[model samples]
Target chain A: MWKALLYKEWIKTRWYLLLALLVTLGFAGYALLKLHRAVALMGAGHIWEVMVTRQAVFIDQMQYVPLLAGLALAAVQYLPEMHRKCLKLTLHLPVPALATLGVMLAFGVAVLAVLFGLGIALLAAGARPVLAPELVGNILHAALPWYLAGVAGYLLGAWTILEPTWKRRILCLLMSVLLLRLFFLAPVPRAYGGFLAVLALLSLCAASLSWLSVVRFMAGRQD
Target chain B: MTRFAKLFFWFLVLVLLLWQLPWAVNYLLVQSRNTPFTLYSEVLDDFVMIRHTSDKEVEYRDRAGNEYTRRAFDSLLPLFYARQLTADGRFPDSVAGRPVTLREAQIASFIFRSAPKDLNRPAPGLHFLLESMSGRVDLAMPSDAFRLTGRGIEFIDMAANRIDTAKSGRFTRMLLRKGCRFPVRELSGNPSARKEYDEGYLLLDADGGLFHLKMMQGRPYVRAVELPEGLRLRHLFLTEFRSRRTLAFLTDESHRLHVLTMPGYGIRRVEGVTFDPERESMTIVGTLLDWTVCVDGASAERYYAVSADDFSLLDTLSYPLSERRIPGLSFTSSSDRYVKPRFR
Candidate 1:
């Protein structure tokens, strides 16, 4: 039953996921290309010095790509369901309603993980030749929170889309904006540090928020 | 599942409210406190303050409520405004009954500032060790950087992204021979070529021992600085002032400020001054005569005048901060770089 639900979501969002993959990877590749071009123009030493002394992450261009990818993916996956009123039917499936929504949220989260993981791996592999391990670690640490925000963005996007009433959806949207604001609060590299784990947990807990929307939808709540 | 979801939803709402409401109120209600620019004047034996009046005009006064004209103010702080006095042909031939020159006054002056945000942030583990005796008219950045490990130090060539084992082993051996422990707890250095000179870095090791490590002519110049008994240092600021009289400013675990003097790395406690480098911001404007140390604390901005020779307290003044703040949840702080839930 879980596989069937997962397959349905995949079939619905496969094409969008492919575009997301290309767009995200393209942004990551462009950022790395810029870093390499910098190295080629003005030796690797300059790049290393800037990264060390000035906290230059080099991949700053890709900071918002993951966020947009997550938001777009959530819209592609859930907007159709909510628009066609298919969520009501999906909830009435043999499987439990909460379990059904859980599977859908899990699928979005998993695909986002794979997409963001590939972007991070590309950055690491491309940066390895020119940067030392410490510089590479700095870039990764700086990018970690942005990638976490992608996960939080997806979950909150789903919560907002799946919400039944227009007024309630606006409230959820406000809350989501404030919550996502947490991820980009500090501009310093690796500023999230240990707090990143808490952010990841909060992103996961955001999964439950969609269930509240589903409960309201089941209760026939409307504007 | 629905019950749990509802509970979690309300928890997030409460968190958002606590974080946002106080922030909004503070943004709307709080006004920034404009602390006057102040300095100790040896001529007056009191702090001279330059502040803006309600009419936006500049006012110069001392703690004794005596105000002075702008030219009189310039004469009061001659060391600070030496150029203005010299240009006006009113420069004193001697100050405090000692022969002085414009160049002498300029070279003897330095300003040192440290804020909690600087000390509270993440350190990029890697450090540059420039050649201190390269015989060049202008210093250059090194081609490699080093990191401290459990066993010793490793220098990585920046261009090749490879460890230079030969250079690494040389410095590591010298550090080990100096009785330095592995995995330094705290390290401070001024590596810029713009500085007049380089003193490399001061390292606090795992065993609470202090070591000075620098590069000279492509070789290691490591010295194990002996600390006073039970003196556990917490932070270090390597000062490369033009005076060349002081090496570094240190703060101990008990929040007392200490100065490590040059020629002999003698550590002397700056009497009657306590600066917690993790919470407050401090600035020291020093001259040949005395230092005006200003420590901005939570509730007050305290100033101390200490003798430049012995760092003994000469006088003290403070202005209480009156700006009100609404306490609530804050994820980021002006004093730190990290994002964590904090309530004050």
Candidate 2:
């Protein structure tokens, strides 16, 4: 039953997941290629010095790509289910309704984790050879908050999309905006070091919020 | 599941309130206060203040409330207004019974400013050790940058993209020979090429010992500075001013500001002043005779006039500032680099 449910989610999100992976990887690769151009023009040492003294992360172009991908995934995966009322049929399957919802969210999170993880690994691998450990660590740390925002954006988008009524959906959207603002309040690089753990926990905790919308749907919540 | 969802919802609401409520109130209600620009006048032996009246009229007055004409105000602060005094032919032969020339005053004049925001912000773990005796009239940035590690200093050559292990070992050995502990606690230097000269860096070692390191003739010149027993230094500012009278300005754990005199390397405490480099901003405008030090505090802007020769407190004045605002939670502050929830 869980396999069937997993298959259903994969079927729903596979094309979108592939697109997300490509877009994210494209941005990550482009950032590295830009870094390579910089290294060639201004020596690797100049790049390292700038990163150390000025805190310049060459991958700023990739900052919002993960976030857009996450939001797009949620829109692609849940908007159709909500519009077509296919979620109601999926809820009536042999599996427990809440468990089904949990599995769907889990699958989305897993796919995002893999995609985001690949992006980060590529960044680290590309940066390590040409830069010192400290500079590489700085670039990675600077990107952590943005990627976390992507995951949170996806979870929060799911919550809003699954909400059973228009009035509550508006409230959910407002709350999500506030929550997502936490991940982007930093303008300084590595400003989110100590707070990253708590932010990631909160992003994962946001998964539970989707279940509330599901329960509201089951209770026939409406405007 | 219902209980958890309810709790989560309330938690979210609480976080929003904590982050936004005070911000909105402060944004709507806060009015920042402006204090009169005040400077100590050595000739008048009083503080000269340029104040803006409610009607927006500018008035210059001494602490005794005696109004002064713009020309008179310039005469009172002759050292600060040297060019104006010379041009007016009112340049005095002496101030406070001490004969001082315009050239002398100009050479002795210096301004040093340190703000908590600069100290508390993020710093890249790299430093340029400019050559102190480059044999050139003007200082220039070094070709390599250095980072202090647990064991020793590592210098990275910019063009070569490799560590200069030989030069690094030489400096590291010099520092170690001077009894500097492996990892330094804090280091300060004016590394810009625009400076008049380089004094390298003032480093506080792990064991709280202070050492001055500079490069002269492409070699390390390390000097172990003797701190007064039990004097725990907290912060340091390398002052490479034109005056060349002081090497650096420092604050200790007790928040007392000290001046590190040049050549001799002795420290003199600027008495009767407490400045926390983590919270307040301080500016010292100095002439040969006196230094007018202003420390901007939470509730007041305090001014201290100190004798430049000895750093003895000559006079002190403070004005109460009323900055009305709603206080609440903030994540980032003007005085710090980290983004963590804080209440003001």
TM-scores of chain A across the candidates, in order, are 0.98, 0.96
Q: Which candidate number has the best DockQ?
A: 1
What proportion of the real contacts between chains A and B does each prediction keep? 0.85, 0.31
lDDT of 1 by residue, A114-188 (tens): 999999999899999999888889988888888999999999999999999999999999998999889888667
- In the range B238-333, model 1's lDDT, one tens digit per residue, is 998999899999999999999999888999999989999999999999977889999999999999999898999999999999878899999999
Candidate number of the best TM-score: 1
Tens-digit lDDT string for candidate 2 (B1-344): 76787788889888788779989988788866657888889888888999888898989999999998899899889999988999999999998899999999999998888888677766677778888897999877777889899999999786665789999999999999999997999999877777777889999999889899999999999999998777899998989888788999989999999989988999889988899999999999998899999999988999999999888899999998888766777777878777777877
Q: DockQ of candidates 1 onward, in order?
A: 0.83, 0.47
The DockQ assigned to candidate 2 is 0.47
